[model samples]
Target: MNAALALHGLSFNYGDRTVLRLDALTLQPAETCAVIGPSGCGKTTLLHLVAGLLRPTLGTVSVCGQRLDELSVSACDRFRGRNMGIVFQRLHLLPALSVLENLLLAQHLARVSRDGAAANALLDALGIGELARARPAQLSQGQSQRVAIARALVHRPSLLLADEPTSSLDDGNAVRAIELLRTQAQSIGAALLVVTHDRRIRGQLDREVVLGGAA
Candidate 1:
């Protein structure tokens, strides 16, 4: 079994404040893993490092067999665009744009042509097709969360990293969001790694890992 994502003695910190002290964590292809821990346990930092959003201060992180430290800035940006999708805790949608527009913008930023039909298909699959024309500010928290998921999956990234994506939803909507994530991950051959403190969702995932430091 090939490991899709791996971390080896990875450590990061802000000045004297230590965060993300991972040691030899790995996830196989097609794996749907849940990361659970208390607040400020370095879950988000780990995700950022895995996604190439941050360079490690020590050790190494790799995804799809590519070592993050070895890639050039431009190469890393392209690699992330072509292979990674992220769902942030804040959703990060543009208030001025409709949901459909927000997704289109993401595709444009990735240098991919905006395919309205495909975008609609993705929205439909995520059960948010009807909300396409709605702006982010107008939707409920649950609705925005679904839109974020749809945007993340629209480009079919091979690795999906989510940070507290479903934390704000009600129980029913939380399950729905997870189901949508699983469906997209399965269809795209993407390994889904979600970081959250929600214990209720543990049994819903195929695997679970705890984030921590040696301290």
Candidate 2:
């Protein structure tokens, strides 16, 4: 089977500082994996690299068989918008857009047809349908996070990348969030790769990929 994501000789450097190094890594279709490590272990950096938000100093990142490193900057952006869904650690929702609008914007930016029905269904599935009109500022951390997840899934991306998705929630909310992510990803046939420092989410995933640790 083709890998949904693959990295070989993946190393990232920040000027004189080398932050991440990985010989090989792969995540298969419909498979869920958690990337766990200590602070500054380059877990988030790895997510950025895979998402095409950052270019690796060495090695290549391939998503859905396309070599991200080989694409032009504009081409990479278009590919990422169409094929990848990223739940940023900061939950980068536009403050001006309401819950529903934020999701709609994702569709618009992806250049896909705007599907209000699908967006509404996703918000309803995530249990945030009632808050569709609420702005991001009005949401609590958990609510905002859920909205972010819904936004990520609106485009039905082949690969979902989430960074520190449950770091702020309590145990209960964190578990719920993880389950929601898994269920939603499976439903959409998207491979899930979540990079988090939260050990609480380790056992909740199908497998764990530890960075900056013994092999």
Candidate 3:
């Protein structure tokens, strides 16, 4: 299988404290891998490193076979914006912007043009078509989450990273959201990495990787 992201002997520390120490991992294309563990087990650290938000102190981190160590920070940021779609816990939508505008803004940041038809179609699919004009402040938690999903997916990235994406959702919505993420990843031929402490999503993943586990 083709790898979308790979990490080799990844170890990171914040001053004297070591946060993550993974030997190796390679996520296959279209693979929906879940990183499941305790709060400080470094699930977020791993995702941040993969997303190029953090640098590894040891070994190499690669995305789409390009070694992160080789890429400059600015280049990494550009690569991340273009190739990775991230659904952060906070959603990070601009409160002043409407739903359509938020997605368009994200697309612009990725240096890609907005696909209005596709964006609207995705919102419609998420059952939020009528919310196109609604700002983030006007939407409920569920609606906001779907909009975040839409924003991440607007550019059809090769990797989709989620940090406990469905934590705020109810059981049904959580399952549906996970399914939607995986389904969209499959449709775009992207690898999906969902980091979560929620055990409910454990059984729904294609493969489960526990942080700090011996392999």
State, as a TM-score between 0 and 1, how close model 3 is to the true structure: 0.94
Model 3, poorest ten-residue lDDT window?
A: 206-215
Scored by Cα lDDT, where does model 2 land? 0.91
Clashes of 2: 0
* Candidate numbers, best TM-score first, in rank order: 2, 3, 1
- The estimated TM-scores of all candidates read 0.90, 0.94, 0.94
The regions of model 2 sitting more than 4 angstroms off are none
Residue-level lDDT for 89 in candidate 3: 91
User: 25, model 1: CA deviation in Å?
Assistant: 2.5
Give RMSD (Å) of candidate 3 vs. truth. 1.9
Candidate order by decreasing lDDT: 2, 3, 1
* lDDT: the better of candidates 2 and 3: 2
What clash pairs does model 3 have? none
Per model, how many backbone clashes are there? Answer: 0, 0, 0
